[model samples]
Target chain A: LQGTVTRKWDINKLLYANNIEPEDVIDRVYNRGGDESEEEDIEEEDFFKKKIYKEPSNEFDSYKPHFSDIEMLKNKWIFDNNNSNIDKEDSAGNSPFALISRRFILSKKMIGEDDS
Target chain B: MAKPSNIVFQTHRNFRIRLILSTLSGKPIKIEKIRSNDVNPGLRDYEVSFLRLLESITNGSIIEISYTGTTVNYKPGLIIGGQITHNCPITKPIGYFLEPILYLAPFSKKKFSIVFTGVTSNKQDITIDGIKWGLIPVLEKFGVRECELHTIKRGSPPNGGGEVHLKVNTLLSSPLTLHVTELPKISAVRGIAYCTKVSPSMVNRQIDSARSVLNKIGCEVNITSDAWRGKNSGNSPGFGLTLVAESKKGWRIFVEDIGGPGETPEDVGTRVAYQLFEELSISGAVCRSQLPLAVVFMVLGKEDIGRLIINNNQIDSHLVHLLRDIKKVFGTEVFFLPDDNVIDQNNENNSILTVKGSGFTNASKKIA
Candidate 1:
């Protein structure tokens, strides 16, 4: 009976009264719930894509630096196996001269380099 | 020899690849269910146009289409390549027709000296720049001589009007064997930016933007611009960039991009340059889209084994299907082995593909 007062329980107020930081509760309640990997991929992928995902408000602000091809290779067939849109954005045509040229040099012993 | 039965195919997918393989292997093909379920069904105008073009340069070739155009029966004939003119449809670019013909021309009775008129560049198809810089070099590996691609007029889509002359001499008795398992560093980079029916300034603008990114490769870059005016220019205004990077071994990789409505010249140039940069960073021996050509050539080479080391990233569904189709038509098996000898661990994800050539020669060519 002593603890029978049905008071409205506001976690924020309780945390405030106790000087407790409701960090975890705040994240769960207000965060958009995207997983960590998804967030990380979005951040890394936007700069590599040629097509502008969104309109630029200002010219200078939308400038994306050119990424090294090695860096671009990081987004290889791993993503393609899932049949993702990223592959579609860059894939060559199924028929004809797709011209998707990235052919690297193929040397064995570094010796037979005579094809010129 | 008995006339081989037709290879039955379903759907309109990969119509061009199948057509070429059938022609080269002398296998008749029956294609059915071409968009049979679609409300507006039947073979598209481009396919019909392409068939007509094939028939013109070939002897005794018979292509019969059903009344509804849903079914097609193709019996390929000897390629008597000499001089021909084809007015291609706007549904596909001029490169669409050229890609297949280039493969057939090497084994023709004479040599290929053809003119193609149609949409020169578009988003959905390969462009002329790609044919010259990308495809042609691969053909050169087969010892196809006196090869040249001259753009007489620049055209865009919709109201398309463009003319191009493609001359390929030296009908090979047999395609040369290819054994490029490794590549040297890129020695130089070159490109051409073209603008038609638009301000000539667009060409320079596009070239500058492309060079801005390509210059970082620390290699020599020579990018030129071509601006067409008046009658030579296509009906629609458009601009595009095509780049070719030559390896020390003389093998080349290509990059290209076209400016569409709402896209700025800078966008096309930068995108193409970045595409090339990205391509160079990958460890493949050929560009992604051109893998089929390289593989097909190897398959059609002399009976000796031809070897190629390809970056694993270049293998996609398209390459997978192309390999299957080649195996089906040519009866040649291609072998892929793990490439564990790469010096750098970062570039170790590759395979060595070896195809035993069928020793296919120009059967129709008369011997001296």
Candidate 2:
């Protein structure tokens, strides 16, 4: 009975209620994935791979994290929970460090839950 | 008691939240970098107008803006409530200004009678109807009675010339503690499909489309269609729909959509109804938009643990920032407990947010 109730209320029904098509959700997810990947690429090129030191103007500067830094922190939380070795070389022949750096970008494709 | 030092913050994010906290805590604050990177930046006219309104209600308040308008130093004064008239800027709807005022009105030194003239409903912010239908009851939940919000004129965006009157009486001696953990069944759905300086047929189209979407969900909706013309209508021509879903427990979920240049009336109606349906589907005490207001009141209420179940997805940056500000100003901590049931994992978007109130009491009491 629970399964029947669950099946009765499906994603298509939600989409219909919201006046959105399945294609729209697909397009939105795809576009979000693309944007995340592009942002990760930029972060990898700028912050992690090459550490450029900048002068801090305010006392609170140390407490503030960059967008890329926040992304890295979220990725680290997921990685620590998954018990994935950070130093292991991936099948793509990328070094462990390189894989860790791009972990957020690569993991983006695996998580497809709708945030709406 | 030792005087508290000033709190310094950077950036222009959540300006209203910071101002509300400062006013309630009676603490001085310095905020720098008000949209510094943007072109023609540093405190828009609307923000300055909001500050002026704040000044009108408070006594001995000190506000200093830098020459570039990139920084502000504010020292809050005693909240002295009385009759006041404010012309809100056209950039924002009257709801934006009314929200913080509602939060502060109960604790005011006297009765408050405010006349606000501006845009009543718009796409960007909450509408006046939502506040009257949704938030007023939430205020009453905290033991506040005799508060009224009435719309004298309906206004839309751009060329706004709307008017709304708000009157809130003094609050109770002790703030009532609230605990809304149980999900209540939706009792009824009410809405207003309003159009001004537009075709009367547009309102019917909106109502029909909205009914089409809501009637399918086994929820009965009673919608009132309103059409204003001539001098009563504002400068702009537009139509919008505002829907409020009331639960058996008296909590409300409010949703609104306004038609603009390209959007059709049918789209506005369907979208607003769908949004309301999505909100109703969430098993929580309050709607997503009311989360911040609830948290703020919880901090200001009598000393007791207030617990609420809210959707995890509804947590926004503004709510997070408000939580942090509460910690800094009131020394109160908020905890989030995620639902851990594996069986309900597929449908569990609800999380529990708990906080202890600071037992704040209004300084001025009415004499019998």
Clashes of each: 15, 0
What would the per-residue lDDT of candidate 2 be over residues B220-324, giving only the tens digit for each residue?
Answer: 589999998888788788899989887666788777778978989988887777666555544267776677778888888788898777765455433455566
Model 1: per-residue Cα lDDT over B1-368, one tens digit each: 98778898777767888888899888899988887877778788988998998899889999999999989999999989889899998877898888788888888898789999999987656788888888888888878866899989888886779999999887888889987766545667899999888898999999888787655434578998889999989788888888888887667777677787798998888778777766665436677656777888888888999987777555443454466568778878766665565433434556677789989878877687
lDDT against the true structure, per candidate, is 0.70, 0.69
- Per candidate, native contacts kept equal 0.04, 0.00
Top lDDT prediction, candidate number: 1
Per-candidate TM equals 0.76, 0.75
Report how far residue B185 has shifted in candidate 2, in Å. Answer: 1.0
Off by over 4 Å in 2: A1-116, B1-3, B340-347, B366-368
Report each candidate's C-alpha RMSD, comma-separated, in the order given.
16.1, 14.7
The docking category that best describes candidate 1 is incorrect
Task: Report the lDDT of model 2 for residue B34.
Answer: 74
What is each model's TM-score for chain A? Answer: 0.15, 0.17
